[model samples]
Target chain A: MTEIKTETDPSGLVYVIGTEEEGMSWIGKESTPVEEPYAIEIRLIEHFAEGIEDPNPLYWSDEYAQQTRWASRIAPWGVIVLCKEHKVWRPEWMEDSGGQDTFFCSTPLPGNKLLATDYEVECYVPLKPGDNVFINEKIIDIKPKTFSLGEGHHITVENYFRNQNGDLCIKDSRTVFRYR
Target chain B: MQLPEIKDTYYEDVEVGDEIPEISIGPLSHTQFLFIASSHHDWYPGHHDVEYAREQGLPDIFMNATWQHALFQRVLCAWAGPNAIPRRIKYRMGKPIVRFDIVKARGVVTGKRIEKDECLVDLDIWLDKQDVDKVTKGSATVVLPSKG
Candidate 1:
């Protein structure tokens, strides 16, 4: 009997498995919409506070929140962050043949690092208990890049968080990865 | 009910190149990671479960992105007044955040602009700890009301 050894071939790497055009087509592939309510009885905000070890009064105490500038109890930022992850659509097709995700890189970033040249988060309203949040997530932008991580499509997933009344509460956008 | 006093940074008060006061947190713990995973309903075992973390090529459960973002928000509010409304927070995760790493949230005011009545503070932020190369880095924007 002979023993055979296996090694990963790093040569001739397929940086972009799909054409730029095909990747562009993925920019608006699908949208995920979900509704969530922040319930007071559950002390949802308190859980977040505990998780982060932050005891901001605005997150749990109505009396303190009423005295704050907003003058009302508001959800912790963590709650909203979890909502973003909750509604994000990570399709199965993005996985490579190796079963490794094409989106996450072995190295997160390369070189001197890019200046956070841009960032925008808009909150039209603060989340409160009994208020329902409507989240509509979509891939809004896609671009080709030969930057630090590697040659791949820079995909931006944007989420619009609206209140039950349809008012925008938060606009969060994160750029994820997809390699060829 | 008396609210915590808010001493806002007005448009005239900040200038480009000013470093926002830095806030330090951590010595990342497994318990914290598990707490966050549970809170977010992110049952991803690698983040908190030790065995799962080892299988994922990590020494142990580490700080996940969600909790890191939550920490960023805490750092942001450290200097921002009650009136400061966070508009954006963009971070590029650099490396695995392991246990007992004391990460520091350091930010600097990069640009300030006036759009109508709003004063927007543009900042370059980075999170790193002793012996740990920067694990997360990005920029943030906030809308602060100007003194009338």
Candidate 2:
């Protein structure tokens, strides 16, 4: 058992290779826009609202939504957080690194002290159930910085969600402190 | 605990410095976190597996960052009306929101303008910790119809 040793990143091995590079090597990288078609029978947005237990009449009844500016049922803006994900290509390393924990084109910190430094999401066309959103993500910027958590990289990920008809539905930018 | 049902805050009435409506949620349950983990791709074992989390040095299962926005979405639509076309939402994540912690989603109107006969409202939004700190911080923009 003495000869047995655990493998390590000897060169301080960057585990999540191509997707995450040293010093802005990945600055211009863009993922193939992921599109997932939503079927009519599923009421995803409403169910998301229900999951949070929000008692909004607009989410519950089309009758109520029509009374407002919207002439039909509309979803709570944040409900889109739970919308079905637009599929994206995952590097084999990422697939094996446990799961999606905000790695977004940067090196992971030593531990789970990551912080949500900042984020931005915008909507152009109102989202409803059965609406297929095509998501395009771009890596805008990454900077090495110091924070309460320790040393980490600050990264910004911008996303644009376009409906099947091609209208921009929602846009979001999330900044994360991937720290040690 | 709850607000009046679906009251419309029209563009003409809203103003800068006014508080963007908010929703409070929390002390999330294990089952709920489990439900979210199962439904979405947020499959980090640390979120559900106590042993894994302990080995990785976490106290217990914790809520993911996405849920903070869920509360924000509820608060915004509750005030501006669901049809209010949202223009943008940006956020900064802070503390780990775990089970049994109450979080309040709050925001304040930062700006407003009129263009193309539509009124646009800009808000600075956040999810507040039980004390003076914030869990997540951000901004949201929405377009509201004119009273006319």
Candidate 3:
């Protein structure tokens, strides 16, 4: 076992490497817009609501959403949390350490934590039904460290949201791990 | 919605290898997404668009990992009934759970032990997407009131 030391980061770590220098080339670059739009139709949105066991009428009722000044039936917050697109790329060292199968390989902290240390979100505009939205992501920073469990590092990534009308919806800053 | 009744489960009543009832969830609708996005204020477009998802090189708009973790509690609560508190849940990302996707939570009783008045039911749980393999898997330990 490798003896590790904790860095000055708020969360102590046993291992650490900076990802910004290695992976920040794509930062601020917009990905090519998709040719075929990923349709988030009303019916599909309704189905997603039911799947998550969400009971709010605004997400299922157009009339309710319209009354509330929302653009359309809204997507679930959990959907964004579950999304896999533009996720932080794992560093080569981290991947080499465990390869494919491993236990507790990664822990991506929610960007919402940046807004509030306790993991809460700040609402700007509600995504309504039929509202077309786009997501853009970038790796902003990285910090390596050693923890009691062993050696690990933290990676922070930023994401931006834009609606069809090109409105800034949300900005997210999230953190993840690359452990040894 | 009224809370489900708390089922009285005893350590003696549960055994290793017993399977929990399977649950089917979803057809996640746009409105549901809106309500969820608005409530959680997530407002991320990749969550509601496949175009954005493809741009990001993903199969579809994926579910938020953290939100899924939180909602998993509801699934556990439903199965364990009201009295059980979700102690700790950990998961890694798999495939994105999309709209109209029906997911199920199943568990095998891994072990059971008694701690005074508390009957601990150790379960190995999985949140699997219907018609597909498992999306996320983890272990949970719930403390149920014992039948003393």
lDDT by residue for model 1 over B110-138, one digit each (tens)?
99998866788988888888777567888
lDDT per residue (tens digit) for residues A1-180 in model 3 = 953322322211122223335334333433332211343456655655555675555556655555433434555434443232222245565533322111111123211111111112222454455556666555555455454323444555555656677776545555554443
Per-residue C-alpha lDDT of model 2 across residues A93-155, encoded as one tens digit per residue: 553432222235233323234445576666666766666667677778888777644776777
What tens digits encode model 1's per-residue C-alpha lDDT throughout A40-150? Answer: 322777777777776555675777666667877677555764433332245786643232212212122221111121234556576777767776666677666664444
Question: Order the candidates by lDDT, highest first — what do you get?
Answer: 2, 1, 3
Worst 10 residues of 3 chain A by lDDT: A110-119
In terms of lDDT, model 3 sits at 0.50
State the weakest 10-residue window (summed lDDT) of model 1 chain A.
A108-117
Q: Of the pair 1 and 2, which is ahead by lDDT?
A: 2
Q: Is candidate 1 or candidate 2 better by TM-score?
A: 2
Return the clash pairs for model 1, or none.
Answer: A15-A180, A16-A180, A17-A180, A121-B87, A121-B88
Per-prediction DockQ comes to 0.27, 0.44, 0.04
lDDT of candidate 3 over B1-148, digit per residue (tens): 4422225455567778988776666776666555555444344565666675565455766666555654555555456643344444445445667777777777777888776655777777777887777677767676655555
CA RMSD per model (angstroms): 8.9, 6.6, 15.9
